[model samples]
Target: MGLRGRWYRGGTSKCWLFDSKDVALHAPTREEIPALLSAAFGAADARQLDGVGGGTSTTSKAAVIWATPDADADLDYLFAQVGIGDPTVELGSNCGNCATAIALFAVQTGIVAAEDGMTKVRMRHITSGAVLSGTVPTPGGHIPKSGLARVPGSNAAGVPVNLSFHGPWGQNTGALLPTGNAVDQLQVNGRTLRATMVDAGAPAVLIPAEEAGVDLSSMADNLSGSLPTLIAARASAGLAMGLRNPEDPPQNAVPKVGVVAPAGDYIAADGTTISADSHDVRVRMLSMLAPHPAIGLTSAVAVALAASVQSSVVADAAGQAPLPGTGAPRMLRVGTPAGVIITEIISDEKGMVSEVALHRAARHIATADIDVAQAAELSA
Candidate 1:
């Protein structure tokens, strides 16, 4: 069978988005969605040579979208992290970068009618229960075929999308600090390390680069060598954050794990010299097992929110002063191997987050019918 879907580049990653109505034609039951997506992406093969999967953690993502009748949201999307060299389709977390793409997809496909200039669409994540608002640019009520705004990790340009999260705290574990503490001392890989486990935007754990035994200066070579250590730290944080039990195996999706460091001079992926004061915080988050080419939008929000918490590992790494108690919004500049990305954070009188906004770019890549003829035949 063929399933119709659209491809898009949102922020730093590429994702394939499909309508539930079209997916249902091929998969009659919800239980079959994972297998269907896995087959279409050639999930079992590491190279994904037989299917549309990009053979990497970032590109091997899909989401089933549909217009919602609910009052709180205009549309809903269930994100899928289709495995590479594995057949699991994880739906445990939300993705902000993909949400950026969906905003444009909605406007282009008429799911949300384009206003004259900026079109706003509110989206709800079915898995993580996060509400996102995306503003799409439409000049003369039309989404241009191309754009000039470039994402931090890529040279390619696309239409800009402004995405904001409303009340993003404690969606999964019922508190911004999942462990009831901003920082925790956990035993990982036979070493006790300090970590901050936050549940905002997405569930994530941040560790200092030194305790994680990684050198951010030589990121590429250091990350590949420290994969095993990174995995251990992530698994430990997940259990501490109550994301999983001892019986449950390690999850590659969440809580998103990474090492953080104070701003320092380093070379970016594009061979550009990044100064110490150029950004507020430095992060090297893992997508699956490897270091993500750039930070994921959901994780980026988590980092910013964690940075606001006093004395947290993320907050300590932040080179800037404490966020004001109740005043003007602040931009938290994050330094990644790709480049610098900015997230605007607004705090209320109680020092709690009022809202967090991330600016990203998205554009339509391609649309076609994906061949998943054997999807349903596989046993669920």
Candidate 2:
């Protein structure tokens, strides 16, 4: 009768759910889906007065699913990153947080059989066609509702979600260095910037914190209200890094920016105190065209990738984490606006990262049925 779905907050993201059998997507056009997505997740207001966006890009998302089409993969998941402050939905991107939600969703829906300790799930992303192998903590052969691992934010400890992606270097485009160079020198707004451009979980621009005139050594509290400048810098950096039209780019898009400086102390937006002595580098990231008070899981991985590779721009920024060999996962601890996120990326002998893993604790708020009238209309 209507679009039946559930809602759950995974890490820093929230998603609207749908079962594929109940709804057949027939390659629907944008006009058919954009309006429904906008209404469900707000596009005009910062607070998303219309629905549940929470005024943050990472929090606004939609997930369309179906039974596994491949016998090898456990479930089929289509993740759409809905722009929080805009009316556009990019179906070509994957959300690490949402991906985590999908695994739990599969287990909850019984689409995936819970295993003893770790439940391995093979997920085929509808957008990039990349396959990701995810392992979750499933105690008693059931998805555990609690765990000892704690993520930087959300303050909720539940099951742990670890995902490793294969062939992610060229996720959207066709090369690790989208422009055929790890570092590119570009001019933006009359400023010269040397950048490392790479495609991992998503597209991103890695910038030296000092070059951007951002003193990462000081606490973020000392740089209060400077987010606008940082955002402008990130936008400029994104443009130089060969992003598709850095100005007025896709709403809530990737190729996020990361500014790094030598380690130092800082206060998080959540009021949590952090000392830089405990971290290798002081990092700040922007999500969806704006500087987020916290960092996204995928963004962190991209930073780790940049850090691993030695370049003119990132040469001195990264610590002494050995480059991973084939089938070996790189352990990366990124200091973000919130606190820290540990990223593990598996790479082959040729320095190609096969998969990425992010382990964090989150709360299982609630899952329920609701009617999405517009989504139903689009299907028709």
Q: Pick the candidate with the highest TM-score.
A: 1
* Reference-based TM-score of each model: 0.96, 0.84
Q: Lowest summed lDDT over 10 consecutive residues: which window, candidate 2?
A: 370-379
Instruction: Write out the backbone clash pairs for model 2.
Output: 165-354, 165-355, 165-356, 166-354, 203-255, 264-276, 326-348, 326-349
Report the C-alpha lDDT of model 2 over 168-236, residue by residue, as the tens digit. Answer: 667667666677776776564577767777776777777787776766644344344555555555566
Candidate with the greatest lDDT versus the true structure: 1
Model 1: how far is 5 from its true place, Å? 0.7
Model 1 regions more than 4 Å off = 320-322, 373-380
Candidate 2: where are CA atoms >4 Å away? 22-31, 69-72, 145-148, 218-252, 321-329, 369-380
**Residue 157 of model 1, lDDT score:** 91
Model 1 lDDT on a 0 to 1 scale: 0.87
